[model samples]
Target: MNIAVSIAIPDDEEKQTELSFDELSDRAKEKARDNYRQNYPDDGWWDSSYEDFDKIADMMGICIATKQVPLMNGKNKSVPAIYFSGFWCQGDGACFEGNWYPEKDPLASLTKVMGHAPNDADLHEIAFGLAHLSERCNQLIPEARVKVEHNSRYYHSNSVSYDIDLPMPIHIQEGNELQHMVFDGLRTKLDLDDEAFETEVSDLLRRFMDWMYGLLEEEHEHLTSDEVIDQYLEEMKFDEDGEAIY
Candidate 1:
């Protein structure tokens, strides 16, 4: 996450004298270093260098978002999702991808919430909802960064990774499966009851969903019908039972 690279586009003056990344001489590199030191003069500043201008431009266009989406299945669990996406003129018109961290003990979470392990249908629904939520979150949210514990990538054996951010805001929504499940679980686990729990949960869910739908509409206005449909199909994952899978 600390891997910082400077892709600063120089001003007209700097541009006129800019050296290519591949052709920079020892003196130029040294001067860049000294200039960085003099200008930044801060700790944790990594070496500054040029990437391909177009690639740098494309990367600069990237946007990030974090979302908490409730699963439609498995007692309506909620999970965290992160996304990186943007439009670029240099290469692909629009590109995006992201990752989500599933609940560590989903079955246990279900049991705690629902009083029993979910059957096959419940499990299928959960998987479908989680996947659907992730896709929707990525598609619906743009240019927003998710909160994470640290700015680091969660590396996998396949060498693929996603940057993790701090926790996103928690909104207990109205008529939300996640809210009911969580409250019910806590109520039973802790033997506590609050009469306003449902109202509070409903309010949170409503606010979040409304905000998301607004963003979704705004994003929709930017694209053609075909593009929207294409994106939807691309993100949709289906199961054998005609359910969407994550």
Candidate 2:
């Protein structure tokens, strides 16, 4: 069920782009919604699509892609289950809602879906592309890194996403100076008796790094849709204990 495709940024000079990440993400999200409307013109998600919106949209918590490949013959680079380029992003920011899902407790960490994706699985490429963008966006916004990965599929996707140049939110060059400042601030804040502010700050930095790294897992851990299918097939051959192990 997984059809593989090679990804390219369209080296053709005519297709190259020069835009900020936010600009690209915003454009991608909007274009996706417009395309979805054109295709599904009448019966849309406004009526009861919020549920689906939450699963993928809110879970990702980032903007959409800048462009999408209209390829119908190939599988996407990531899980086709994500609709990174549709109205989901434009609907209500559900795609970038509060920290993924704050209301659910995982049976171990569960993210329910209406199904894998809608009729057009191509958006998965766009969504995956944006996820890849999240890491770059993180440097721009420190809070993004501090946010928990519990529901931020978008964040995870970005870390897993291909690397690109992005500016940091705080204007500070990389050096021991930044670390010293962070350490000093934490040392003092930790003494504020209400609860120790410095400790909190230190933890925040750690959490930020956690968010940064959470996205990068071995290929075995990053479950693209194709991988999911593979997982199912492997499961069919054996049980969880891994004797035959599928």
Candidate 3:
């Protein structure tokens, strides 16, 4: 029952419940609503989804001559397309054949990239909506390094993520799902109130359908930002599902 938002573009935390939505206006209120919408949609934007990995791989131009990835029935809860990039291929064409290993591929000059979690925890679809985003970021937040955790490609490679900063004022720290859980005491909050709350949450979700579709379409585009992300994920031979392609 606690709502949160972040002003840091990639973060959030709540101030106080005493402040009504009306008390804030213009940029403050619009930002609040956007944050609210991002976390809790009317129809649960975080719901489970069909993940077309082969499709995702093809989009990133991964080798598909084999057409048989470890994934056969398709994956689920794929990350936002915004999080991917592609890697270069080798003379052997294993990446295209889907026979390359993340830890041993030779793609140092490819253009196609894909998105991958900084680690494997990102492979599962946790209720969606940036669930563990805070936990992995905790150690790095104090030093302004948020992207490192999302890399998922390396266990402890000296990656560039460490170079980026993710400092959020403590005021916004509460917007983090972890901090919010601690602040709100999540255990005693989900019972009898379900019936009355279900519909409202469902409606809130419809608002983001357009956003999701746009992301999917963008990810599938012939050219995109994901190409770069995938390129980085390539250092570890990670595939679209965040699994080691080999």
For each candidate in turn, give its C-alpha RMSD to the true structure in angstroms: 25.8, 24.4, 31.2
- Give candidate 2's total backbone clashes: 13
Ranking by TM-score: 2, 3, 1
lDDT of 3: 0.29
Position 84, candidate 1: lDDT: 20
Q: Candidate 3 clash total? A: 45
Q: Taking the tens digit of each residue's C-alpha lDDT, what string does model 1 give over 55-119?
A: 22122221223334444574542222322222222221221233233323334333432333234
Per-model TM values vs. the true structure: 0.17, 0.22, 0.17
Query: lDDT scores for all predictions?
Result: 0.32, 0.32, 0.29
Residue 168 lDDT, candidate 2, scale 0-100? 35
Better of 2 and 3 by TM-score: 2
In candidate 3, which residue ranges exceed 4 Å CA deviation? 1-24, 37-53, 56-246
Using TM-score, give the best candidate's number. Answer: 2
lDDT of 1: 0.32
lDDT of 2 by residue, 1-246 (tens): 999998766556453333322233444434433333343423322323323333444434422222233445784332212222222332211122123211122111112211355442433443443343343333233233222222444432222221112223354556768765764454344342223422332343233223323222222133323334333333232222221222
lDDT, candidate 3, at 128: 29
Pairing residues by index, what is the TM-score of model 3? 0.17
